[model samples]
Target: MTEPQTTHFDTVLVANRGEIACRIIRTLRERGIRSIAVYSDADRNARHVSLADAAVRLGGPAPADSYLNVRSVLDAAAKSGSQAIHPGYGFLSENQSFAQACADAGIVFIGPSVHALNMMGDKIRSKNHVAGYGVPTIPGINEPGLSNEQLIEAAGGVGYPMLIKPSAGGGGKGMHIVEREEDLAATLETARRVAQRAFGDDTLLIERLINTPRHIEVQVLADNHGAVIHLGERECSLQRRHQKVIEEAPSPLLDDATRARIGEAACAAARSVGYSGAGTVEFLVSDAAPGEFFFMEMNTRLQVEHPVTEMVTGIDLVDWQVRIAAGEALTVEQSGVHLTGHAVEARVYAENPERGFLPTTGTVLRLHEPSGAGIRVDSSLADGLEIASHYDPMLAKVIAWAPTRLEALTRLDRALGETVVLGVHTNTEYLRLLLQDEDVRAGHLDTGLIERRLPTLAFRGADDHLLAAAALFLHERALNASTTAEANAVWARPTGWRLGEARASRYCLGVSATDSVSVGVRGEPGGASVTVGDGSPVAAGLSAGHDGTMSVDYRGITRVYEVALHGAVLHIGADGFQMELRNRSRAEELAEHLLSRDRVPGAVSPDVRSPMPGTVIAVNAASGDAVEAGQTILVVEAMKMEHKLVAEAAGRVTVNVKTGDLVKLDQIVATITPVNTPDKGATE
Candidate 1:
C-alpha cells in the first residue's frame, strides 16, 4: 500500500441533530476544531445548536425537508466553509449518495469510501459479500427485488420464525418477525411500506431467526493505510421490540478464544470492502451455542452504543473518525487495544414504558442529571427544552464504568435513580428494575429476555407519598404568592383556618382523565396535616431549600424533590420516578364525577382517543361507519413509529380525524356510539 496524503481541517460540520450531534461537537471542541451544527425547525433551540461554534438552518421539521435533504446539507457545508462533514449516526450517515455528493463537492466525508458504503449499506448485498469472503453468515434468502410472492414462497426453505429486514437501513426500523405462514403475507406488505417510507427503498431480505440469541457486535477501525483492528465486542442482547435498551462492553458470554475468533472475522469482513474509519460488524450468537456465531450486518457509521466501547477501551471514536478522514494513519495496533473496566449504558427516551413504550412529548420543566464517580451522561436535555415527536424519542444516555460487571450494573442503576427529567414520561425506573432482575444480574441474557421479563416486572405508580408531596408543594407556592395585605387578613388567608377546627382544604388532583386522587390539607403549608384519599391523616410540612429543591416531610420521612409547576400541573421527580399531577377545579371535579356516574352498566366508552401526539397517517374507518370491536380505526405516526387506534366496542363510528391531521395526546379522534343508542340529532 502507498502512503496516503495528509490534510488538516480547521472547521468541520456535523450533519445531524440531538444527542449524537452534541456528542460529536464535544469531540471536535476537545481537538481544537471549530464545529458547525445543522438543525431542523423543530430543533432550532436544541442543545447541539448552542454547543457548536456556528450553526445553519437546514429546512422544516420533517426529515425529508431538513436533515435528510442532501442538497441542503451540502449547501450548508459549502456556505459554512466546512472542510469536512461528519454525518452523525442517524440522518445521512449510511447514505451512499450523500457520501458521493461530499466527494463531488470537494468536502471530505468522515467515513468509509462510497464503495464500502454501497457494499455494506445494503444488508442483502452485504450478507452475500461477507459470505463470499468466507465469513460465517446466517442462513437466509437475500436476493434484491424479490417479489412478495417469491419471498413468501421462499420462506418455507428458510424455515419458521424468520426475520424480514429492510436492506437500506440499520436500527430496528422496518424489521418484522413471522412466527407462522399465515402471518407472512400481511407482515410482508406492512414491512415493505415501512421500509419504503423510512429508507426510501423497499428492498428486503429474509433471515432465519435465531432463538434465544445474543447480539454481539465488534467495533473495527481501519485507516487509509492498510491497518485494521477490532476493539472487542459489546453485549446488546437486552432489547425491546428489536431495539437495544441496554449495552455493555466485553461481553460476559464470550471466552477469550471465542472473542478472538469473532474479532478476526469482523476485521476480515471490513477488509473485504476495503473499509475505513470507525464501523461495527454485528453478529448473532445463540445462547444455546455460544461458541458459534453468524454475521448479521455492518453499521458503516458510529453507533448509539459506541460510548460503552469508549468507556471500556479509552478511545474516542468520533475523534478518530475525523483524524482518519484527514488522512491520518492508525496509531494504535491490534496488540495495543485492551479492554479495561466494565462499562454499562442505558438509554433514556422520552417515552412511557407502562404505555407500551409509546413516545411522549413535553417540555423539560426541570432537569437533573447524575454526576459522580464512574458516571457519564451524553445528553441533549436542558431546562424548558421542548421534546417534540418530529425526531427520535431518545433524550439522553447514562453510562457507568466500574472495575467489575456487577459494580458497573450497580453504578448504572444508581445513576438512573439519580436522573430526573420532569414533565416528560421516561423509562428510567424501568431500566433500574431491569438491572435488578436475577437473570440480568447473573448474565443469563438473550435477545428475548427483556420481552419475557417485561410482564413479570412490576412498575410503580404514584403512591400516597408522591401525591402528598405534590399537594403540599402547590399549597406552599400559593401561600408564598399571596399579597402582603392578604397575608395579614384572616378572611383572605388560604390556610383553611376556622373559629373551632381548621377546615381542611380539599384538593382533587388528576393523575389522568380517568384516575384521580383526593387530598385534604389543614393549617399552613409549613406545618400541615395531610390525608390522601380515605387514609389516616399524617403530619406533613413543606419547606423551600436554597438549591432549588423542595423538602417534603410526610409521616416522619423527609425527602428532597425536584419540583416544577407549569400552569395548574405539578411535576415532582425523585429517585428516577416522575409524576405529573394536575390540580382540578371544583367544577371540573364535579363534571368528571357526573360523567363517571352517568355511565350505564355493561356499556363501553364510545371515545377513541389518540394515545399520543402525532400525525394521522391513515384512516381506516369513515365517519358514520359501523365498526366492530378491536378494529383499527386509524394509524398515527410519531417519531417513525406507527400506532393504530382501535375501536373498543362494536358501534357506529364517527371519525373526526383524517389523514395528515395532527392530533394531540388523549385527543378524541373518533367516537363509537353503541348500535342501540339513539342518535340525538339536535343535541349531538
Candidate 2:
C-alpha cells in the first residue's frame, strides 16, 4: 500500500447523529481537531450539536432527506470548513459512492478506499473475493446467472437447513433460514423484499446453515503499506432479529487453533480487498462436534461492537481510522498485537423488550447512571432531553471490562440495576435478565440464542402497587419537605403532639401498560402501606424511602419508584414507566378501598367511572343531547395517542365537560341523555 498524496484536515464533520456522532466527536476534540456536526430538523437539539465546534442543518426528519443524502452531508462539511468526514456506523457509512464523493472532492473519508468499498459492498463479491484468498465460505456459489431451478436443485445438493440470503445485503435484511421444502418459496419472497429495501437487489444466494453456530468476528486494521493485522475475534452470538445483542471479546467457544485460523482468514479477507483503515471480518462458527467456521462478511466501517475490541486490544479504532486517512502506516505488527481480559457491552436501547423491541420515545426526566471501576458508559444524553422518534432507539452503550467474563457479566448486571432513567422507557432490565440467564452465562452463545430463549426474559419488571405506594410516600415527603427554617417548626410537624392521634390514609392502586393510578394514598414517616385491586385479589403493599425515591412491594411484584413533583404535574418513574398523576377521583376510591379491603370498612363507590385521567378534547353531547349506545361522545388524548370516549347506554347527556378542561379519572365526561331512553338490556 502507498501513502496518499494529501491528508491534512483541521476540522472533521460527523456525518451522523446520536451516540456514534458524540463518540467520534470526542476523539476529534482530543486531537485538537475542530468538529463539525450535521443534524436533521428532528435533531436540532441533539447531543452532537452541543459538542461540536460548528454545526449545519441537514433538513427534514427522514434519513433520505437528512442523514443518507450525500450532497447534504458534503455541503455541511464544506460549509463548516471540514476537510474530513466521519460517517460513523450507519446510514451512508458503507455506501461506496459516498466514500468516492469525499475522495473525488479531495476530502478525507475515514474508511477504506473507493475500490475496496465497491468490492466489499456487494456480499457475493466480498464473499467470492475472500473465498479466492483461501478463506472458507458457507457452502454455496457466488457466481452469477444461476436460475431458480438451479437454486432449488442446489438446495437439495447442499442438504436441508440452508439459508437464502440476498447476495448484496447485510444486517439481517434479505436473509431467511429455511429447513423444509415447503418453506423455500415464502422465505425467498421475504428475502427478496428485504434485499430490495436494503441493498436494492432481490437476487439471492443459498448457503448451508450452521446449526446453533456462534457469531465470531475479527477486528482488522490495515494501512496502504500492504500491512494488515488482526486484533482477535469477538463473540456476538446473542442476537435478535439477526442484529447483535450482547457482544464480547475472546469468544468462549474459541480455542487456540480456531482463533489462529479465524484470525488469519479475517486478515486475508481484508487483504483481498486491499482494505485500509478499521474494518471487521465476520464469521459463523458451529458448535457441532467438528466445530467449523465460515466467512460471513466484512463491515466496511466501524462497528458498534468496537468497544469490546478496544477493551481487549487497548487501541482506539477511531484514531486509527483518522491516522490511516492521514497517510500514517499502522505501527503494530502481527506479533505485537495482544488481546487481554474480557469485555462485555450491552446496547441499552429506548425500546421495550416485552413489546418486541418497539421503539420508545420520551423525555429524560431524571438520569442517574452507574459509576464505578471497570465500567464505561458511552452516552450523549441529559436529563430533560427528549428522546426523538425520528432516529434509532439505541440510547447508549453500557460496557464493562474485567479479568473474567463472569465478572464482566456481574458488573454489567449491577450497572444496569443501579442505572435510573426517567420519562423514556428503556431496556435496562432486559439486559440484566439476559446476563443472568443460565444459557448466556454458560457461554453457549449464538446469533439465535436470545430469540430462542426470550420467553423467560420477557417479564415486565415494574409493579404498580409498589410504584403507587412509593409515589404516595414521595408525595407526603414532598409536601413535608416543602418547608423553610422560618416556617418549618409550625407548618411541617403536623403530628408532633403527644396527646394527638398519628394516622395515615390508604390507597387502592391499579397498574396498566399505559397508566398507573391510586384511588387513595396512606402515608407515614417510616413507610407507606397500600393495596392493589387486580380484579381478583386486593394485595397489601408497603413502600419506604428517605428521599423522594420509594419502593413498594405487593405480592411477588416489587416496583421501584422515583417521584419528582415539578410545578403543576407530579413526575413519577417506576418499572421503567412514567405516569403523570392529575386530579382523579378514582385515586381516592382505590385508596379508600385499599385501606378498607378485608380489614377496614369498604367505601368503594358504586358509581360508573372513567378508566384514566385525560383532557376532554370534545364534548359532543350537551346536557340534553341524546346518544345511541356505544356512540362516540367525547375524545381524550393520553401519552400522545388519542382515545375516544363512547357512550355505554343510550340516553340523554346529563353533563358534558368542556373541551380544554382536565377531566379526572372516573369523572363524568358525559352521561347518557336520559335513563328512560336507555338502550335495551343496557343499564346506567
Candidate 3:
C-alpha cells in the first residue's frame, strides 16, 4: 500500500439523478470540487440540482430525452467546463459509447475503460469472458445474436426452470424464469422486447435457474495502474421479481475461507477485462452448497447497494472512483482491506407494496428521516418534492451499521419505523416487515426469500385507531378555522352544542374508493367523545405541535402523527405506515351508495381505471370489442415497469386510452359493460 495523494478536478458533472446524484455531490463538495448537475424537465427542482455548484437543463422528462441523451450530457459537461463526468450508476454509466464519447471529447469518464465497459457491460459476453479466466459460470446458453427461435431450440439443453435474461442490462430488468418448455418462446419474445426497450439491445441469454440461490456480489476497485482489489461481498438475497430490496455486507452464509475464494474469483474476473474504477461482480451462490458460486454478471458501474459495503469497510467508494479516474493509484492493499462490524440498507421506494408493489407518485408534503448512532440516509427526498413516474421508483436508501449483524438489522428496522413520507405512498412499512422476518433475522436468506414471504407478510392498513386520529385531526382543523373566521359568533364554532343534549357532528370519511366510515364527534376537539363506524363512543383529544406533528389521544392512548393536507385528502403517517383519508361529503357518500345499489348483482364495475399514472404502451382490446373476464385491456408503463390493465368481468369493452396516451391515476381508461345488463348511460 502506498500513501494516498490528492487528485485535482476543478469541476465534474454528475450524469445521473436521484439519491445517487445527491450522494456523489456530497463527496464532491467535501473534496472542495465544484459539482455540476444535469436534470430533466421533471427534475427542475430536484435535490441534487440544488446541492450542486451549478446545473444545466438536459431536456424532457423521459430518460432518452435527458439522462440517456449522450450528446446532451456531453454538451452539458462542455458548457459547464467540467474536466470529468461521473455517471452515478445508471443512464450512461456502463454505456461503452458514452465512455468513448467522453474520451473523444477529452473529458474523463469517471468509470471503467471503454474496453472494460464493452466486455463486462453485456452479460452474455462477460459470462463467456469470465469463464475463460477459470471462473465458474452457470450452465447456460449465452451465444450472442440468438433469435427467439434459436433460443427456443437451445432451451432443451438448458433444461426447464431456466432463466431468460437480457444480456445488455442489469438490475433484474428483462429477466424471466421459464418453468416449462412450452412457455419458452413467448417468454423469450417478452424478454427480448423488454431488453430492446430498456438496454437498446435485444440480445438474450439462457441460464440454468439455481434453486434457493443467494445473490452475492463483490465490490472491486481498480486504477489505471493495473491494481485491482475486492472490498468484500454484499448479501443481496432478499429480493422480489429479481430486484434487490435489502442488502448487507460480509454475508453470513460465507465463512472466512469461502469469502476469500469468492473475493479472489471476483478479482480474477476484473483482471480478465482490464477493469478500472468502481464495479461489482455479481455471483449466484447456491444456498444448499454455499461454497459453490457461479458468475452471474459484472456491473461496470457502482451498485445501488454500495453504501452497505462502505459502512462496514470504512471506505468512500465514490471518492475512490473519482480518484481512480484521475489516474491515482490504489493506496489500499488487499491485505489491509477489512470488513468491520455489520451494515444493512433498505431501499425506500415510491411504491405501494400492498397494491402489488405498483409505482406511486405524489408531492412530498412532509418528510422525516431517522437519525441516530450508525444510522445513515442517502436520499433524494425533500419537503414539497414531487415524485413523478418518469424515473425509478426508489426515493431513498436507509442504512444502519452496528457491531453485529443482528444489531444492524435491528437498527435498520427501527430507522425504517421512524421514517415518515406523508404524501407519497412508500415501502417503508414493508421494509420494516421484511427486516423483522424470522428467516431474515436468522440469516436464512435466499433470492426467493422475499417473494416467498410476501404473501404472508401482513401489511398494516388503515385501522380503527388511525381512522379515529384522522377524524379528530380534521375536527380540530375545522374548529380552529371557524374560531379564526368568527371569534365573536359562538354559533359559527363547531362545538356540538345544542339546546338539549349536545348533537354529534357527523363526518363521512372515505378510507378507500369503496369503503367509508361514519365518525361522530360530540363537543369540541380538545375534549370530545367519538364513535367510528358501529363502535362504541370513546374519549378523544387532539393537540398540535409547532413542528407540524399532531398528538392524538384516542382511547386513552396518545401518539404523535405526521399529518399533511393535499387537496381534499388528508395524509397521515405514523409507525412507518401512511394512509390517505378523504373527507367525503354527505352527497358524495349518497351518490356512491346509490351507484352500488344500482349495479347488477355479482357484476363488477364497468369502468376500469388506471391503477397508476403512466403512459399507455399498448391497447390490447379495441373499443366495442367483447372481452372476457381477466382479459388484458391495456398496458400502462411507469417508472420503467409495465402494468397490464385487465377486464374485471366478461363484457363488451370500450377502450378510452390509446397507445402513447398519458393517463392519470384512477382515470377511467376503459369500460366493460357486462353482457345482458342494461347499458349504463356513459361511465362516470
Candidate 4:
C-alpha cells in the first residue's frame, strides 16, 4: 500500500548493440533520460546509433575490439558524461569484473552487486548456493582442481547422456550432449576450446541431460534494500541447439501450485546471492512429473526473453532495473505483482533455419516491421544496413500478447507473416511454420522439440506462385529500364514482333544458378501471361509504382511485390516470402558458358570454400597432408559461433588461409584432391 519511489539520472550509456540497446533507449527516453550508444566500425550507421542522443565509436567490427572492450566502454561513458552505464545482456552484462570496474570509476552499473554476480557467474557456485536453500538442482559437477581425466571419471558417475557445458557461458555456446563414452573426450575438448574462445574461460561442467524437460525461468527483481519479488516465469521450451527460439509466459502446463513453487524457489535463489536489479533464475521442469523442477542456471542480467514476462505483468523491467540501480526500494510486494494474460515472443533471426540454421550476412536492402493490436516488434534495423557476421544473428523480437495463449500464438503467427526483410535471408517463415505445429499449438513443448522436428522444418523449395512472381518481377524490371520511346515502339508492334509471331519467351528464373524454373511470358504493355514449368498460363496485369513495388493481378487475386535491384540480383518480397532471383535468357546462358573456359569437367579442383563470411580460427591440415572424409579441416568463427568445415571425401589437403585471417563469403580456404587408386589392369 506504498506509493512507488522514483530515481532520476540525467544520462545513461548503453554498453551493447542491436535490439536490446534500442529497447533500453526507448525506456530511457520515456523517463526523459539522455541515452548514449557505443558502436563498432560495422555499426557506424546502425539504427541504435541513430536513435541515441549521442554515440561514440569503440574500435573495429569484431566484438573484442569494440563492444566487449571494457576500457573503451568506460572511456565512452566518461566522454558522454553518463551518470550510469547499462550493460545490455550478452556483452559483459553478467560480468562481475565489469560491475566492479564501474564502481571503481564512480559510474553506476545498472545490474546486480559484484558479490551477487560472482556467485551467479559461475554455474557451480550458484547451484551450490541455491541448493543450500533446499532448492532442487540438476545433478552436475564442477571441480576447481579436477584434471581432464578426473572430469571424465566424474562425468561417468553422473551417468550417460550427460551434457558437457561451459561453466561461464550462456546462449547455447560451448555446450554439447554426449550419448556415449566413446565421444566424451572429443566433445569435451571441442566444448572447452569453443568456451575458451567465446567466454575466455575453458572451465567445463558435466550435468545430467534431462529428457523432455521444459525450460522455465522465473523473472526476479530485487533491490539494494533487501526486498525481492518474482514476476512469474516464461516458458522457453522451444529451442534449437540448446538456444531458445520462442518464449512464452504463464506456461500452460504449470498449474497454480507448481507456478508458486517455482516462483518461490527463484526468489530464494535471488535472496541467497543478495541479488539486486533484474535477474533470471532458470529451472528445468520434468514433463512427466509436472511439479518436479531443478535449478538450471541463473542469468544475472535482463534476459532476451524478458519481454514476455513484461507483457503479462504490465511492468517495465528495464525501468525497474534502473530504479533499483539508483538505490530505490522494491515498492511492489509479491501480492501486488500480477500476471494478466498470455504472451509469446518469437525471435526473428538473420539465419537460414533450412540450412542447419546458418547465420546469414548481407546488406539489408529493405525492412518492414509489423504492428497491430497485440503485436510488438523490437528491432534496430534499417534499409541498407549491413548485417555483419561479428555478433549475434538475431535481427528482431516479435512479441504477441493476448487474453489467452492460443490467441497469442495465433497473433504471433499473423505478425510473423506480415514481417518483411530483404537482402538478408531470415527465418520468419520457419517461425510461422513452427507455430502451426499441432504439438506447439497444444502447448506440448520440450527442450528437444525443435531438434526432433527439424526434418519437417527444412525448406521445401519455393512454390509456383513464388516463381511466377520472380519472373513477373524480372519482366517488369526489363520493361521499366527501356526508354519511353523504345517501350512505345515495342508496344506498337505485335506481342512477339522480334520472332515474327505472337509467341512467349521462355526465360530461366532461378533461386540460384542450379535451382531454377522455366517461365513463359508473353505480353505487350500493362498485361502478360505467365506459365510456370509446363503449367497452364495465367493471365496477369502488371504495373509499377513509384516506390519500386509491382502490382500483379492473376485470376482475380492481386499481390504486390516490393522489388529492388542490387546489380545482378533481384530481391523480391511477396506473400511473406523473400526471394533473390537471378534471371538469365537462353542466349545469355550460352554466352556465359562459352566465355568461361577456366573450369574443365573432371579436372576441376575440389576446393573447400567458406560457406559464409567469417574469420578462419584454425587450420587442421596443411598442403599435401592427407585427410579422410568427415574430418574437420578448418574452423571458422562467424556470428559468434564456430563452424567446423569437414572434408567430403578422402583426399590430399591444401590449406589456403592462415589462422586469424578474415575470409569472404565463398572464399576458398582449402582444397582436396581425391586419393589416387592403383591402375590394376595396367600393372597386371
Candidate 5:
C-alpha cells in the first residue's frame, strides 16, 4: 500500500508533566514546532513549563483538578491555540474517552485511534480481540460486572495462583496475585477500589498466573497507512511492587527465532486494533518455557523506557510519534529495522529505599546528572526544584548505550555512580547496588528478582572518608562565605595543633540526627590536617576544582567529590551515593538523646505521621479505637501510589485528619496511644 503524505501542525500542547513532557518538548523544538505546556499549581515553575514556548495553567496541584480533568486540558489547548495534543505515557495517555474528546474538539491526539484505544485500553476486551487473531494470550475470564461470588467461582476453573487485574488500567495498579481461595475476597475488593480510583473503572479480569515470568514488551509503530513495524523487545523484568524500575532494549532472554516470533506477534496485535503512533505490546514470557510468552496488555502511548529502544534503534520515537500524528507514513519498513548495541535505562525515583520505598518530597538542594559518550539522561530535575508527591516520584531516567551488553552494564553502572540528587532521599544508591548484583549483571532476571534481592540491598552507611570529606566541604564553604579578612585568617590557622587541644576545633557532624561523627581540623586552604572519628590527626589537602568538585587528598588516598552547601546541610556526591550531612554540637546531640530517652515513660506518641505530602485517601482508625502494632491507621495517596500508615506499637488510635485532607510530611493524621505498652526504641 502507498503511504500518505505528511500533514503538519505548528503548535502541539503536551498534556502531561515532568520528564516526559520535557522530552516531547525537546522533540517538538527540534522539528521547529512550538510546544505549549500545561501546568498545575504544583508545577507552576516546573522545568517542563519553563521549557515550552508558552504555557497555560490547568488548575490546582492534585491531578483530578488539573491533568486528568479533560475539560481543563482541552480548554488549555484551545486557549494556547494548540493544533494537537500529545498525552505522554501516564495520566490521560490511554484514556479512550479523552482521545475521543480530542478528536471531537478537532485537536489531533498523538496516539492511536479512539477505536483502537477502546479495544486495547480494556485488558479483557483486548485479550479477547487479539486471541481471535491467534496471538498467544493467557487463559482468563474477561466478562465484566462479576460479583465476588461469581469471581470466586470463576477462579476455580482458572486455577489457584491466579491474578485479578483491572480491565481498564496498566502499571500494575489494581492488580493482585491470589495464591489461595481464602484471600480472594479481600484482595478482590482492594483491587477493585484501587482500580476504580486509579483508572476510574471497577470492572476487572481474572487470569491464570504465570509463575515467575520475564516481562518483555515489543515496541511497535504504525502510520495512518496500513504499515506497522516492531522495534524489537525490551526486558522490563526488574521491578518493585510490579512497577518497572530498570529496563533494557534487545532482551537477553530471546533467541533470534523467538525474538522474531514475538516481534511478529506484536505487529499482528497492533494491526488487529489498527494501532497507530508509538505503542508497546507487553507479554509475560514463561520462565520454564523459554519460547513461550503471552499477551499482557498494550500501552497506546509512548512508554517511559522508550529511550532505551531509541538508543538501540537509533530512532527518535517521540519525533516519529509527532510525525505520525501529523499524518506521515511509516518511513522504515520491517526489512529496514535494525537493532544496534545494547542500552539499559534505570529510573531514578525520589523515594527512601530503606523505608519500604516510600515516596519522598523536598526541594532539589543539588543536582548533578552524569555526562559521557554512552550516558543519556532524560530528566527535568534542577537545583531548587521541588520533588512533589502530587506526581510520579521518578526524578529521571538514566540510560547508557554501548557496543555490547556487558559494556552497557558497565557504562550504566559508572553513569549511576557519577549521578547525584540531594535534598530528597532517592533510589540512586539502591539502583547502583542492583546494577552491581551478580545476577543482574549476568542477565539472570525475572519480575520477582528485586523483591528477592531487596534484603541484601540494604542501605550501606557512609564510611569515615566520606564523613571527613563532607566535614571538610562544609568547612571550606564556611571559609568562602566569610569576609576577606576572616578568610585570610582561616588560611593562617596553625597546622601543628596537638590532639585534644582546645585550639583544635572538635566539630560534631551528623549523618542523621542521631549518628554524629567528631572531626578536628587544623590548618587551611591548600594544606590542612583533619581528624575523623577517634583516629589520630592525618595530614590532608583541600582545594576546590574548576568543575564544582572538591579535590581532597588524605594520607596516601586522593578523591574528588561534587559538594553543595545549603545552610547547615552538606550534600556530598561521593562514591556512588548522595550523602547528606549536618553539623551539630556535642551538647545539642546529647540533649536530643536525653529528651528522647526521658520522654515520659509509657506515654509514647502513637501519632501516625504522613511521611510525604499528600491527600488522605482513607482514615481507618477512629478516636479511642484499639489497634495493634502494624495495623493500618490511615492511607495517604501520593505520587499516584497509596501508602498506608501503620501503628508502630499496639495502641488506642485517635484520628485527626479526615479523608481528602491535604497533609504535609510529619503531619500527624492520627494519634495512637500505646495500651499498656512500654516505649520501645523507634523501628529501624
Candidate 6:
C-alpha cells in the first residue's frame, strides 16, 4: 500500500491528562495543529479537557477504564478526527503495545519506533545492547537466577555496595542502594517486591554502586535517514529518595572532554538501536576516579527534565519529536547545536516533606506561581482543583535559566520565595530553604543530596516572617474597611496623639508565611491614649480618619491595614481573615487537625469518597452483598496507578460499581448499610 501513504499527518490526539495534557495542547496550538484531548469521566471538567480543540470522553475516572486502556485511547483518536497521537510523558507513553497499536491504526505515534522502545524500555535488554555499541556500562548481569551461593560469591567478587533496580522502570519505582554487604539480601528482596507489584516483574540485576555519583544525561536525536546529534548534558544531582528534585543544564561536574565523551557514547547507543525521534542517554558520573561516567540507561521518551535542555540548547525537543516521527531528517549537526546559558529546575510537589514524602490530597484554594526574569512554571493544576491521593503529588516543575550557575540558583531561590499556595500544604518553604543551604549553592551535590540534608531542608513550620505577614495583611485590610482607622495602625497607633479622650486601642490581625494583614478598632476615635495588650486597650488621641484606610509602621516596614471587628469574621478588602477573640471554633479545628496527624496514606473514610480524579478497577463486593468489618471494598486507578478503597466496618454493599466503571471523588460509588442492621452471621 505504498508504505502506508508516507507522511502528511497533523491534528494530534493527547492521550493523557493533568498538567502535561494542558502543556501539550498549548504547544499544539502554537504549531497550528488541532489538539484532541482524551479524558475519563473524572476529568470531564478538568483544565486539560477545556484546553483542547476537541475532547473525547473515555469512560470512568480510573486509569484502566480510560488512559491505560489501549483500546479506549486509540478509539478516542479515531473518533476525534486526530491523525496522530502524542502520549505525553506518562500513562501509555512508554507502553510499547500502545505505540504499536497507533502505528497499526495508521496514526503516527509522536515518539521513537516500537523497536527502540522495546530495546530501551526493557532496561536489561538496553543495557546489554548498549555495551556492544562501545558505551561504557557498569558491570552488571541481566538474568534473574544465580544460585544463592553464586549470588553471594558474585557480590563478593564484584565488590560490595550495589544498586538493585527494575529493568522496565523510571521515576525510581523499584530502585535500591545497598552499601554494606550485610544489607544486600534484604534490600534486594524489598526492591524486587515493589517492582513485582508495580510492574508485574520481580526480576532484578546487580550493578556496582559508585561512591559519589553525579547524574548526567545527554539528549540525542536521530532520524531514519541516519543522522544523529547530541544536545549538551543536564546535571540532575539534587534528589530526594532517588528521585530528581532539582535539575540543571550544562552540568557543573562535566568538563568539555567529559561532555564530548558522554555525548559521543550516547550517539553511538542511538545508532546501535536504530533509534528514531528524541531520546535521552543517562549516565552516572563517578567522583571516585578521574572523570569517569558510566551508562545508566536510555530513556525511550521525552524526559520531565527536558526543559533544562531546552533553556540551555535553545532547541524545541517536542518539535523535533514530531518532525522526526514524520520521517524528516535531522538538519542540525553537532556544531549547529550550541549550549548557551545555565538553567535549573525544581520539582514542586504536594506532600509533607517531614512525613516520609507521602502524597497529600486537598483542594487548592489559592495559587500564586513564581514569575520573574527567567523563571517558568510548567504545571497542570488550577485554583480550586482537588489534588487527589490517586496520582503523583507533584504539582509543577519550576525552571529558571540564567547566565551562570550562581545566577540561576539565585533566580530559582527568588522564584520559590515569591510562590504562594494556600489551602493545600506544599513544600514551597522546604524548597526555599534548600536553595539557601551552603552545600547546594556550592554545587557539592549527589543523588543522596536532599536525603542527607533534609534535617535542614525539609523544615516544617510557619516562622516569624509568615506570622508578621499574616498580621500585617489583616491590619491593612481592616483599615480599608473602616472609615475611622489610618493605614499605619497595625498594633494600634502608639497610645493617644490625636484629638479625643481615652479610646480602645485594640487591633485584630491575620498572619501567615506568605501573607499578612491587620486592622484597627476605632469605636471611640481621635480621643485619649488607647491601651494595647491582649484585648481592647485605651488610646486617647488616636483620630478616626474619615476615609476607610489605616497605615502602620511596624518592624521598619510601613503597611496599610483595614480595621473592622464584627463579632468574628474580619473582612479585609474582600480577603476575610476570621479573627475570633473567643476560642469557640478555631480551637476545635486545631484540635481536630492535631488528632488527624497520625493517619496513614489512603486511609480516608469509606463514605468520604476521593476528592480528586481517578478510576475504579477492583470491586470486592457486589450490590446487596455483605462485607466484613474493615474489608477491602474496591480498588481505584488514577494516573496509571491503583489505590484500594476499604470498608470502615462490616456492611452490606447496596449500590456497588463495576471494575470498568468510572467514579468521581464524592460521587457515591456504592452505598453501605451497617451489617448489624439486617443480616445475621454470613460466612464467606
Q: In TM-score terms, which candidate is top?
A: 1
Number of clashes recorded per candidate: 0, 24, 0, 0, 1, 72
Off by over 4 Å in 2: 1-6, 144-150, 289-291, 458-465, 477-510, 513-519, 523-529, 534-561, 564-684
Highest-lDDT candidate: 1
Mind giving the per-residue lDDT tens digits that candidate 5 earns over 515-592?
Answer: 578887766646667888889888877777322588888776888887766666666766567766777866787886
Note the Cα lDDT for every prediction shown.
0.92, 0.74, 0.90, 0.85, 0.85, 0.69
The stretch of ten residues in a row with the least summed lDDT in candidate 6 is 574-583
Per-residue alpha-carbon lDDT of candidate 4 for residues 411-456, written as tens digits (9 for 90 to 100): 9998888888888888887898899999999999999988888887
Give per-residue CA lDDT, model 6, range 1-684, as digits (tens). Answer: 223223755689998887778777887888888999988776777779888998998888667898888998888898887888989887888888899999899888988888888888877788888988899888876655553345656777567677878877887677887779888777777777777778876667778878878888999998778899999898888877678888899888778987888899999999998888888898988755527888888888888888999888888888777777777778899999999889999887776455445445556555667787888888877866776655566788888999999999989888876565544456666777777789878877788777778765545332322223333433334445555556356444433235665333234332221122223334323232222323343232322332233443333444443333334433222111111121124454455456457545565443525333356667777877887767777877654446666667667776557777767534567666665454467555
- For model 3, residues 197-243, the per-residue Cα lDDT tens digits are 87778999999999899999999998878899999999999999989
**Predicted candidate 2 versus true structure: per-residue lDDT over 277-302, tens digit per residue:** 99999888887732578998899999
Clashing pairs in 3: none
Off by over 4 Å in 4: 1-7, 458-460, 484-495, 503-506, 533-538, 544-548, 551-558, 585-588, 591-607, 622-627, 652-676, 679-684
Alpha carbon lDDT at 580, candidate 2? 45
For model 2 the local lDDT of residue 674 reads 39
TM-score of each: 0.97, 0.78, 0.96, 0.92, 0.91, 0.75
lDDT of 3 at 638: 93
**Candidate 4 local Cα displacement, residue 393, angstroms:** 0.7
Better structure of 1 and 3 per lDDT: 1
Which 10 residues in a row give candidate 1 its minimum summed lDDT? 542-551
Q: Ranking by lDDT, best first?
A: 1, 3, 5, 4, 2, 6
Candidate 3 lDDT = 0.90
Whichever of 3 and 6 has more lDDT, that candidate is 3
Q: List the residue pairs that clash in candidate 1.
A: none
Which runs in model 5 stand beyond 4 Å of their true positions?
A: 1-6, 479-500, 522-539, 545-547, 585-587, 596-610, 613-618, 622-626, 652-684
